[model samples]
Target: MLVAGSASPAEAGTGQLLVHLRSLLPGLAGALRQVANVILEDPAWASRATIVELAERSGTSPATVTRFCRTLGVAGYTELRVGIATEIGRADQAGWEVGIGADVLPTDPIDRVLRTLLAVDVQAMHETAAALDLSAVDAVADAVVAARRVDFYAAGGSAAVLEDQQLRMYRIGIATWTWADVHNGLTSAALLGPGDVAIALSHSGRTTETVEMLAEARRHGATTVAITNFSTSPIADVADHLLGTSVRETAFRAGAMSARHSQFLVLDLLYLAVAQRTHERSTEAFARTADAVAAHRTPYEPRARGGSARSADPQRGA
Candidate 1:
């Protein structure tokens, strides 16, 4: 599988051509980004266009087009075209007729807004799944399972996502802490050792605080992991493992909002993998936690034939 930081686009499979391109867009240099934009702007046309035609359209030389193809990890122009064609075909077969980038106007009806948002979120989830590296996830899971401690770092919406992972890990008896504050996160990271694990969450992978925290952890000899939408971001540089999320952002939704579901999907997979590895302990923890909260919930009561509520306990008769 194409582990975010380690693999090239060719390793990600042709089906993920568009997604890989989009994720790499932010990190590409000027001429290369222009070429990428040309293809992304009209994939169908680009898929069928010749190399010279693409160069002309992108306002770059044929050499630059060849460089763009090489940057994408394809052999040459032909392979790039084939990848785009395959991606387009796959999208068509999946019935993704709705434009995920459609704008939601202020005057639009609630249904239209709903449809646009749904399409964007669902497409993000699908793309994320398509590009995720399961082997990377398993490796991270194994690290977490054996770690002496795990620290999670993030800010804003990503902080909320990391909190969810923190809670899950805690419930399963894993030693985990979450830091939204940069200062505190750096302190925690500095204390981490070779047996520790540090995970940072960011949509763009460029969040300064989160990146710094992960970098600090790595410097302290901890295993570092970065979960983000862009694989080539600064955070990915310091991470020992990079997990990429493919998020489709619209004007109405920011990167963090668009990335929520996809981030959750990746974390859920990691959490489940960890749980599976520690099955006995995880089951025991679940049972203990459930019992601890059982008394806080009210018992369900059924309604009697006479339209009155009846308690299940005969001792507390209705």
Candidate 2:
């Protein structure tokens, strides 16, 4: 009872694909598009489809239905089912929702940190795969490389990410700056010129202060980039290009855990890529940075040896 080609990829559910059925339905040489519609409309039944069950539903042959699933990126109907379920599983778990259930307590320290890390990692992978636009990423990278200056800013928990990135870019000799305070962030943005770039980091992508800085940066004719979650959010709208991480977070979990992890990963990718592009400058900068740090070092005894030196001796310095 469904028309074909009416659904677009934009409207497709996470697990349920939208197929163009009108083109191949009872036309000059059509067979499977009709079947695809039947499948697309009710992904659950289609997921469990047998060739005969599917053939009867779409008025197509068993072989035709088998061909349809393969045509639509599945190995066969069985894969189509399991794949859809997996996608649905992902959809169900995305976003920030805290559980209020009775505390399930495990006192193992190592297990706790590992579990949290694993959860964040899983979320990061999902968010990245779901939201990453390769073309947009390439465009952002090209713009960063081509820019004369790049400024980045963050606040609250996201500040850690910007601090780390600031160090990395400083090492590679990119003309980069990071601001955690609002005063400096805005000041930095206000000074931007043409061919300059600004990057804003936020997990929720809706921080008023961060967005204001980004807005100001844009006014100065600099291109803006956002590393954030939620594509339809404010940061994504303001950015010239967006990069996202897929960490589903809840309120009760550790603060700043997932967001910090995602931001670091993105910055690392950009840092290494920029380094490769300007290998000579990066190498010199890295060596210079290392030398400067090494020059400031103070030799120190081991903690145990220092403690022994200060041991409470009854005879004072006789």
Candidate 3:
């Protein structure tokens, strides 16, 4: 939950709303879900519309809208409107604001689709970064750097993110491995001990396989970290450190689109923190790794594209 006075002006309006929406989406139901979806579809109108008007637009009643507002921790329709209006005002002030809840319909042109995709992804990253708890991130990074071994458990799209993180840590000389198969992941989790770190990535935080591995690792006394969209999920309950991403599922890109990007940003943030701690080793690893692959690539050829080209020396190749 966002604190009363924690968010800055830039982050207070739409940013906090996105956070709430992402967090509460999994639990929304019935007419409340419809109401929430309507608000997401058009924030500016939602901000200014009366309760009765919102109800008419959403195909629900004013009482249902009030119930939805209460679910979001707002006093009533009036407070909800105030919050939305605040976001709309702030968004208007910014020249290049993107709506987090915008969608790409099948009827949209290719260019329009591209614009919507880019806008939503960019907004998700911004909101995720804005809502990130840096202190928790620092703690997770410290745990990773100090761990005897690190195991990443993920599946589906999140599994891809896990593999990328594994490669990144390996490049920096940190011992990390990820498993896509649940049996293999569970087997790996079984070997983890008190000094080991187990990180789980799930969008809904309810994936049984991911949750089981995290539980197993926790049972074995490993420090557990969860990266997910919902903070109140089962994984969050078992995790020692929680890193959340605020990315809503759009009509076209529901499974892993914006969420994956947010996950990557979190992983990158953690990786950078770890890299900063062991700078010498990381730099040396980069140098050695670079040299190992340097001979495989063909050197630049001069005048291949009719540009200025004179030198063939490796350092000054065109």
Per-residue alpha-carbon lDDT of candidate 3 for residues 1-318, written as tens digits (9 for 90 to 100): 333212322344443664666566667778988998888778888878888999999899988998887677676777787777765564455543455457888799999888887777777777788777788888888988899899999888889888999998999899999987889988999999998999999998899999999999999999999988876677887798888887878886775666888889999999999999989999999899989999999887566345455543446755
Overall local distance difference test of candidate 2: 0.65
TM-score of each: 0.93, 0.62, 0.81
Model 2: lowest-lDDT 10 consecutive positions: 1-10
Which residue pairs show collisions in model 2?
A: 4-22, 123-246, 127-246
Q: Which is the leading candidate under lDDT?
A: 1
Candidate lDDT scores, in order, read 0.87, 0.65, 0.80
Query: What is the per-residue lDDT of model 1 for residues 1-318, given as tens digits with 9 covering 90 to 100?
Result: 233455565787887888888888888988898898899888999999999899999999899999988788888988898999988787767766465345678888998888777776777788888888878899999999999999999998889999999999999989999999999999999999998999999999889999999999999999999998887788888998988898866777788887898999999999999999999999999999999999999986777665556454567756
The per-residue C-alpha lDDT of model 3 at residue 97 equals 41
Sorted by TM-score, highest first, which candidate order results?
1, 3, 2
Across 1-318, the per-residue lDDT of candidate 2 in tens digits comes to 211212222333334332212212222136766776676466557657677898999898988877775555455666656755555456456642311111224554876656655655655554454444556566666777788889897888787778788778877777888888889999999999789999999877778888889888998999988877544456766787777654544444542455566667677777777777888988998998898899679765344443553354445462
How does candidate 3 score on lDDT?
A: 0.80
Residue 138 shift from truth in candidate 3, angstroms: 1.0
Error of model 2, residue 207, in angstroms: 0.2
Deviating ranges (above 4 Å) for candidate 3: 1-15, 29-38, 49-79, 96-100, 304-318
**Candidate scoring better on TM-score of 1 and 2:** 1
